[model samples]
Target: MIIMPQLSPIDVLKRSNAAWLIRDQWRNILEDAYELVFAGINPYTQDKKAPRSMNRQFDSTATASTVRLANRILNEMTPPFDNWADIKAGALLEMTMDKEQIAALDQQLSGVSKLVNILVNSPTAVSARSAAILDTLISGMGVILGIENPEDDVVPITDQAVSQSEVAIEVNARGEIGGIYRKRKIKVREIKDIWPDAVIPSDLLAKLNEKKDPEIEVLEVTYEGGPGSNVAWYYEVLMCAKGQDPHRMVERTYDVSPWTVFRWMVIPGMPYGPGPVLLGLADIRTANKVVEMILQQAAIAMAGMYLVRDDGVLNPDNIRIAAGGMIPVQYTGGNGGASMVPLGTNREFDLGQLILDQLRTAIKKHLYDGTLPPETGSPRSATEWIQRIKDLNQDLGVGIGMMMADVVQYVRRRVEVLIKRGMVPKISVDQLTTKVEINSPLARAQKLSKVQDVINWLQMANAAAPNAVATVANLEKIVAWISSMMGVPPELLYSEEEKKKIQQNIAAITAAQAQQANAPAPSQAS
Candidate 1:
């Protein structure tokens, strides 16, 4: 291996601009998503204000529902401080490694998951990730990007959720992410600290001295490159200021991409996916409008709207109807010539109520609002509870699958950086092929039924014929199944190779006991 040269940063900037133009196709929808579901934090602007339509979402059902679902989604996908994913040894690795390497490999595999957790559980990671998950729900795409942070000894990983507005991605026909381009506004003073390669002008320093802290933009792009055998991800950074040519900052290449892109759904040939919020945006708007109308109706009934004759002295604009306010009216003719007549507040509320309720229910269900069953309802049996969790997970099956897939790639990408940084022991290519099994709360719930099923089967088998139990049940598989269901941390459990060693020990002990039992007592006979 000879390492190939990376593209110049200027080229990176040009390609990124082209991709961003494509992302603009999603600009309007992304704006709508942030308004309705993500609390209007527009990363596109430094002020981060929501768009004006934020007020239009008066019903709040979509916003509330989005938040509730995002939390649940996070807990299920990658709960903070919990072992949400497990790294399992692939079959090839297990069959190849002998007893001596078994314990070492197991220990190595265990540490990988624990260390990855520490990196992800960092304050910044969770804070940003929470937003990214919401972005996934609201805009259909969310991003977890690993950038240089100098303040840390561990993986200088950012936990800040990158706004959709800051990111543009190119996806291939096979649903693989081909490129990721992100732009950020940074204060001139801090640029030197973040990117060691950054150069600051004396003029910029003078501005910083004046406490100006003028903002400069940086465009970072990571794109797939290399011919078939030499395939790799390339990275670049460039200074991107309006009305100026992109100045190259730095460039590099990596075996794995630093970007972890999450999409709610994958539509073939589409560069991005749209989440449930976009699907229900119409309903959300409609519901909000209906509620606002209903409130207006109530206001009209309480503080009656009135019409006055076109009288010379009434001056309708001056009319003030407070608790005890006074209004002067001139009487000039019949009915005082300034008499105010009531404008009818009378209107039907039933139809609006119906539409609103229906929209709310649909929105809540779409967002997985986690509405609990009535506490007054009959208590559920253990079996019923297990089944319920299974049903819920099944309903979330597709989204969960997509999220977990992204997570697997994310973990592997993290491993690439971690190994180079010596944060974790280096795992070979075969080891990297290991499975990333999700073990989140929802996963545990879905697996609980399997555990129950195994237990019930074992109990029935032992009751029907105790002697046949050993043949009917694989003790190792049974225990492993139970452990998975219990959501045991990978660090605390034995790997497949280690379990094989344990089974061998058990078999040896059993064989010895049987041999002793069969052996005759020759000394006693003599």
Candidate 2:
């Protein structure tokens, strides 16, 4: 069992204020930004019980375009782990170890991998929330948390989406996350479920169980340096439970794990991070509105030919219009009738469409639509496809690296929690110190680039002096290097027995060649 220190209500409030203040400051901007991305409206100023109105009658092109970009990005850059089943596939990660340590390392890693699979495969896994948060992130920014005990499921893979408005983060100069304060309104029932065995007053439990529109409270979890002084990381979590005034519930203290907040890109001068899609958001929104407005105006302009009456009896208000129908009207005075006249025979729509296309092109360029794969048909050849993929990757290379880093850190934290909870074998805990290698396509492409350079050099060397190159270089070592860089599993490489036999054969061949060279003069005498 774990123990946490109890905190007075005032102390809880104090600890929460710092985070709350930061959140309040960014909420207005982030809230609106996220709304624009997901809900297609600006909800920053939405009041209680007031119906929110759309600022512009635009469709979800921004949201759809963002989704398309994210899909392409993820597709081009595969996740390091193929799936939960292959978490220990060995293709994605690297570790330094001797022959003797290999078995132990694999065993330890198996446990950790299984635990990760369990966490990631759960109903509320990161994969489930990734699309939503990713869309929000691209639009402006978004936040996601890998909570240990979400209380919604039994398997404990609790990934939750934190509204951008509720999170405040601080990053160091090196871009490492220094601290994070995430405040959310969790229901009382959820709190009870999360801390199932906590010592809560019976009366409070009774009220909570009644479920009469359960009260929600601000549950703030903060992570910063300090606390467990010698440990690698330490953090604190304080909860202000409903009805527990003046004395808040101390969820935990000195959490030995790191924070699970994932930030896509850090804002230049801001204390928190920013989104990739936010850079061109103003242009996108403007173009979307412009298109919508143009469509509406064109429809109004082309409604039909207007009938003008000199008697003023057949005005727009008195006219009853129907598609493919003729209307009958009686003239009130002699020589008074309606004449069908076109609304705007001179009004042109081609210019409006041109402007619309130009605006869309701006949005497409910023969102990287042109660089991504086309919606229909394949590239002419595999080479062409590869080149296109490489181009797309290069476009977002830095951003991809940032995402990979965050994913590694997030997985590390989850593995640590599993180890602490005894879900994984104790032996595997030491392996957590190893660096995680991202095996995503972009990362693989980088490695492939270096390998290709080496191959090219080898070809050039062979062309210059094939015999000398072959004799001077260790072919086995070269093959091993190339195979390793190509992401071949270590288990699939040549066994020790095969390697020994190959080395012996090479030695025999070299000896025979030397003897033949020495005795060549006698054979040439004939």
Best by lDDT: 1
lDDT of 1 by residue, 98-121 (tens): 744754665567777777777777
Which pairs clash (backbone N, Cα, C closer than 3 Å) in model 2? none
RMSD of 1: 5.2
lDDT of 1 at 75: 72
Q: Per-residue lDDT tens digits of candidate 2, residues 217-303?
A: 554554444433433443344545655663344444323344455455556766555565576667766766677767666665656
TM-score of 2: 0.74
Deviation of model 2 at 467, angstroms: 2.3
Candidate 2 ranges beyond 4 A from true positions: 1-12, 28-36, 40-59, 76-123, 132-136, 149-156, 171-175, 197-199, 202-211, 225-247, 253-259, 304-346, 373-386, 423-433, 501-526
User: How many clashing pairs in candidate 2?
Assistant: 0
Which 10 successive residues of model 1 have the least lDDT summed? 323-332
lDDT of each: 0.72, 0.57
